[model samples]
Target: MAGPEVTVVIPTVGRPSLAAALAAIGPGPEVIVVDDRRDARTPLPVPDGVRVLATGGRGPAAARNAGWRAATTPWVVFLDDDVVPAPGWAGALARDLGGLPGHVAGSQGRIRVPLPPGRPPTDEERNTAGLATARWATADMAYRRRALEAVGGFDERFPRAYREDSDLALRVRRAGFTLVRGERVTVHPVRDDGFWASLRRQRGNADDALMRRLHGPGWRAASGAPPGRLSRHVLTTLCGLFAAALTAMGAHRRRAGRAAARIAGLAWLALTAEFAWARIAPGPRTPGEILRMAVTSVLIPPAACAYRLGAEVALRTGGAR
Candidate 1:
């Protein structure tokens, strides 16, 4: 069979990085850019050959779908606005897909965050580039047009920017199509700078719960990957809180108040040490960044867990509205 025509679909929210993304693509490929914002505030001038679509404030999933639907190509490659493909990325993608079997539905590429030395990633940066491993990132993922159509494209229920790619990938896999990782690479530059802004973005935890409700409890370890040390931190915090409360109550009953206090104190120290170490070892930092890390580290676990739990409950109960 002849190689499929490739249509590169990029969903953008008017980020300046879109230009870099466009410049990275080599010639001889159809390009589609979906502007999700839809605002009449003057669209950026795309390169002469690229087709642009405006979705008028719909989410990325919708933008992607629009781009794909508009594509005449048999294969649709999705790239995020912030991603810049490396040299030969398009050629590598063509070669990779050409080599895949008929059952292969999609391909993922490696994503790297080109961070400067001596600075730990900000919370927002971590959120954006944390998935740098060789896997599925919307920034560098491509899908067979037929396969995407078979799975009904991306689910619009994933309102905000999270887990929509995984949802689609899981669906494609369940439909008896294989999603293989490709040799092509892209750089996901970390653009978010504010600390608290990143924390507020944890609203995606609600979407995680939605994914779990749709896919089941195993979705966390399966689609979303493991919860990591954040789970452990939550447990430690609860244990310490329980011990402290018990110790205060036991003072009237002459229970082992001293032992309980010591345990609680040890737990607090352990938590702080874990937080400091997680932040410090990445690289050298000024006292301000270190201090910010320390504060955010202590707050991140509980905030994340709370969001996750709430999202899970809401999604399971169908109360996301």
Candidate 2:
């Protein structure tokens, strides 16, 4: 019996790794590359026979919707541009989908993130490695086209490449379809996004707020996401804000303000130190790594809280996108 027809849909921001991803896919099934770069003045160079669609930088969720919607096959596989499929992965994927029942809406490919052999992995490397066990990661996920249509595809409200996959998977499962692990594997390489990468990632906290609002506060448990330090972050942020406010108020009521400031300042210091140490303890203890952790830890709390608060406010005001 013939395997189900599959089309690989890759949403890209013109990363250099996109070419490698396409090459690793090796030209069997129909491939659609969604060009999601904000600037479309320069044409993306893709190999012959690979179709390209433009989303004008609406983000991964929108780009994916564009790619899968354009596909005519029964199966639409979504692959992140930074991943490399294992050799002969096309055949493995076919076999994975061949005997699946109609109720099986999706098949997830195992992801491997290669860390350095010598010495402990850095914080960034360890974070990247988490994708290996991330539930329903789109790094290499395949969904039956009909299931996608039934659920109305990905929610474009998820503007970034975070939480969108989990949200979709939860929705698909709730719609009465099952998802399973597949035999095929893909490699997700660790990226060097510079020193402030961790700080920048706090933007996802806003998306998390949206997840809670849409799927309820139990969304994390329902979606298999880890119980994150959001409560701790909120506490840290409160401490920081109280310390600053008390310090500023010291001009009028010197004695009372000084005592309040001292208490809040100590709480903020302890929280920040603890957060930094948690990250530093697990990885390489190089001075540079320590400094990055210390600095980002101080900022991440406030940044995360601000994002979540902003998203909540947006949701309340009908301004969330």
Candidate 3:
């Protein structure tokens, strides 16, 4: 089958990788590139015949919505600018949707993350590579246009790309459509954005909390995500706080405060050490990498706890309809 049934929608910030991404895709279906860069600083040069739309600094969820709505094809295929499609990807995508039942809403492409050679990957690299096993990641995914409209597109309230795709998947499933794994393959190359990327990624903690609010506690299992260690992060942060408070009390008191402080101090040390080593072991162990891991590990638990707490209060109070 030709690729006419599908229109490729790429929502991108001004990454140089977009050119290579377009190059790997065979010329058959129409491609719509959504420029998510709000500023005019870096303009994406569009290929001939490809349509370009600007979301004016709105995040990816809105950009994707714009792309698919503009498409007239029966199937709307989404690709991230950073991914490279395998040869014959167009046909593979067509085949993936060729025989699906009417109740099937979408097909997710298989993602391959290539790892660095020689030394083990750093914590950040390993995290990026985990996308290979991630479900409904939308690095490459296709949806029947009808099913997409049925759900009112993605929730713009997501405000970021992190859990937005998963939220859409869950809604599709709840609406009686099943999502299947497709045969199409795309390679998601690991990003090397220096030391601070992982720390910055902690912002997703608020998104995670929003997901729980929208989809309920079962959202992770329903969407095929791991249950995660939010509980453990909370425990770690609480232990550290208790240890700090006990240390202050121990200075003023003698017997009970000292024993309790010792216990809390040991617990905090053990948790923090475990967290640090989990990061340090898989690392490249460069001076910069080591320093980054130590700082982020200390910061991540508290940050996760804070963001989640903030999200809970904000969502419950109802910012907008």
Q: All models: lDDT?
A: 0.78, 0.92, 0.86
Off by over 4 Å in 1: 38-40, 117-129, 224-226, 236-273, 319-321
Residues 142-258, candidate 2, lDDT per residue (tens digit)? Answer: 999999999999999999999999999999999999999999989999987999999999999999988988899899988888888889998988988898887676632687777
Q: Judging by TM-score against the true structure, name the best candidate.
A: 2
lDDT tens string, model 3, 1-321? 653388899999889999989988887788999998879567687778889999987899999999999999998988999999999887888788887888988999999999988988988889888889898998998998999999998888888879999999988988999999998999999988877787788778898888888888888888888766678789998988887887765642767777777777788778878888888987888887888888888888888889889888898898534
Scanning candidate 3 in windows of ten residues, the lowest lDDT window is 248-257
Q: How do all models score by TM-score?
A: 0.82, 0.97, 0.93
Cα distance off (Å), candidate 1, residue 232? 3.1
Candidate 2 residue spans exceeding 4 A from truth: 251-253, 319-321
Model 2 CA lDDT for position 150:
97
- As for TM-score, the candidate ahead, 2 or 3, is 2
Q: In terms of lDDT, which candidate is strongest?
A: 2
Task: State candidate 1's TM-score.
Answer: 0.82
Residue 204, model 3: lDDT of 88
